[model samples]
Target: MTTGLLNKSTSLDMKHLTVFIYLLLSFSTPLALASEKKNILVFFIDDLRPELGCYGQDYINSPNIDALASDGVLFNRAYCQQAICAPSRASMMAGQHPDTLGIYDLTSPLRRTIPDSMTMPRYFFENGYETLSFGKVYHHHTDDREYWTDLPDVPGELYANPRSLESIALLKTQAKTRGVKGVALGRAARGPAFEAADVEDDAYRDCAVANQAINALQRSKDKLFFMCVGFAKPHLPFSAPQRYWDLYRREQFIVPERKLPQGAPLLAFTSWGELRLYQGIPQEGPLSDEQTQELMHGYAACVSFADAQVGKVMAELDRLGLRDNTIVVLWGDHGYKLGEYGLWCKHTNLELDTRVPLILSAPGFAKGERTEALVEMVDVFPTLVKLTGGDIPESCEGTSLEPVLKDPGEATRPYALSQYPRGTKMGYSLRTDGWRYTEWVNIENKKIIARELYDHRDSQESSRNLVELPEYADLVSTLSKQLDTHQRTAARKVKAGQ
Candidate 1:
């Protein structure tokens, strides 16, 4: 189960900053080679929305994940700066945004930009962690090889719809298969299970990763460990075993309430159509609403599959008596819009595309606590530094949310931001408790485009576009300016001590 480990080229847009920023961050060793309290287990899932039993979504049966939430702080308002896989993972690992890291697309590896900056697990290793990663934690799979002692399985490399590729090749040969109109989910794959009874989450390559992670946790001891168990489920092939699929009766799952409003003023940069396609869903071709409910049912099953694998590792931590000392963090890279705004996956400024479920459970947070204050995935890096009792590098872009961990409702900032590059400029989304404000800026090109305003109270499902609403004009303008200050300061934060 060797993962796809390779070096990726840098994104053309932010290469200059990445080069300078990379040269700046140095992984300084922890002051004293002595005491540390918690082991960190990050259960990183892919393309999973917070539709688990804990988040109040009734369709999915995810008891293990829900139990973990009950035992920890469930962050209802968490997010990745971008929604794509490699880019999102890189941003979280590096504590940098796509714009700054210059790894916005899957084609580029984060290493090409800032090859020297320490990663999340590497920080612990510098301070005394025996770091091990299984599955996809960072984009450059090769980077994992540098930090991890073992990688049992690689992520999905099956192209041409390995989902349908086998049959498609067959179909291509059969003349009757000509002009195939519909896409098939295709045949099931094969993989090992946690237990003979453990349901397989489709024969996803990630399942093997989960099994390997369990094996590692069971065997690990002594030194403080940073273990990342990444489950590549719910992300694609959208494939999972049929048994769990039978559990979610799709008609019971409701499409979030949404309606295109009249006179909706189009903001200059609001992703009217681009984001849907980014998710592998197309811009046009409205789905003939149906037993697609069943399709969602399958998604629910994938969630359950991921949850079960998470359970496997948690069971191991407890088996090793590491639960009392481990800081367990569960997070999805970014939000996925099932059908909201007609978008299938991610890449949009809306809450559905950017928001993620972040839960931190440890000795200190043993009693359930949560933070309404929005936080970015980048913050997880600095937060780990604080947890490991290590010096935070001067160039880190995020603030430590340790304060919020003490009290889930505590504040780190007035708002949380998610920003990324599009063509020559950057698009920014600022999330406050009550509203979401966004703008697109390109200083070199002298362009500040598109504004987005979503009043969560009135429009939680994000059914209406209020960026152009006369009433919210002042609010949008104010937030747009604030975005400029936020981005500049953050970029400078990463650039500091260079």
Candidate 2:
């Protein structure tokens, strides 16, 4: 009887051991998968518009960006909060709106506005990710240095052409004659608008930025990283390699009609004083046809040059074997005008300036898909957090775009809002899937000064203002109410600091 009891007891113990082993594997398998967090690679291109070959512009040579779009979901209607570099970038990085931060110009540092606010990079850093910025992640390089794991080493040789250097020398000499000196002198002296030198890509700053970013990727393959590689090209001076310029013919470029939208208020237009700073551009009247065509060609060439840099960085990411577990996002700070509506640069609340190119390529998301869903720059913060399995902060004003990434047919927001400030007046523009409506309001009085409504169903460009047309009165009223409601709600959120 004692021997039989011993055998029975041993069988019971074995059964218990087998059940425990099965339970342990079931629990640990998911835990191991959860622990494998994906890395983030962000490309911040300055003053770029959605005019690449991926966006159906066959004339533009952007193979790298097009390939990126093919590998991910391309957002067809991504709008910036503000159309300028500083405010737009600040809004994006802070995960807040420009109105929330009260930043409308290039000079204001975001830290001054919200000292304790958690930036996207800082959020990643706090969550045990190595965050690094390779180039102009912020409008000013020194703006948010403390938040980054490390900033890229200072680059060399902004311009390579001898004539471009000569123009800078001339501008400095002219400024010195007026008693300008120090930083003020440096600011006053500007270079030519366009340069295409017969030199290597490293002769410009963007190539160096890509090189540094590749080095960062090599060292970061083992760790989860939030790497931001910003490319400063297709921006002012439009300096690029001669080979890139040779990709396009100046005569074949299609120049827009050199006129503002009919029935649009003068306040809706900019003096385009930004373009006048360059040596070749005319200070006052419209550019001649030849000059316009050449500028177009230069812009296109710079776009191609920037695209090549993107290819180099992405190649390194692939070679490092990080592509499978990495999330890649490429976007511009804001859209460029490219002589659209006779405008030369960003700073308007128009579609050409506010709309940006946004692409997201990640493992397990919808691949080779295009989504017409409206997304804003602010939404990027929460989306990244969600993708990385981190908790989105309560202060984040934008919604997570994970669902849209999963199914390209999903709609996250009804419309995207963008704003720009002009002196005492501020323009708030609302873009829906079919139309765009804008209202310019006086800041002090809070009175609506002017309004603009453009029907974008027919064409992307705004040919005329339709706000006063009797047929669209109800639509205008509806959009106006929506804008008011959103602004009021956003204001309350900002005041509460949520």
lDDT against the true structure, per candidate, is 0.69, 0.90
- Number of the predicted model whose TM-score against the real structure is largest: 2
What residue pairs clash in candidate 1, if any at all? 269-450, 370-408, 371-408
Residues 1-498, model 2: lDDT tens digits:
999999999999999999999999999997786666889999999999999888888999999999999999999999999999999988998888998888999899888878887888889888878889987888877776777887866586668988778889999999999999998787678787889899999999999999999998988888889999999888887889999999998888878887787899999888788888777788898887788888889888999999999999999999988998999999999988877777789888888899899999989898989999999999999999899888899878888999999999999999999999999999999999899999999999999999999988767787889999999999999999999999899988888874
- Residues 186-216, model 1: lDDT tens digits: 2212111111123345355666777777777
Give all TM-scores, in the order shown.
0.81, 0.95
> Which candidate comes out best when scored by lDDT?
2
Off by over 4 Å in 2: 1-34, 182-184
Error of 1 at 134 (Å): 0.8
Query: Model 1 — TM-score against the truth?
Result: 0.81
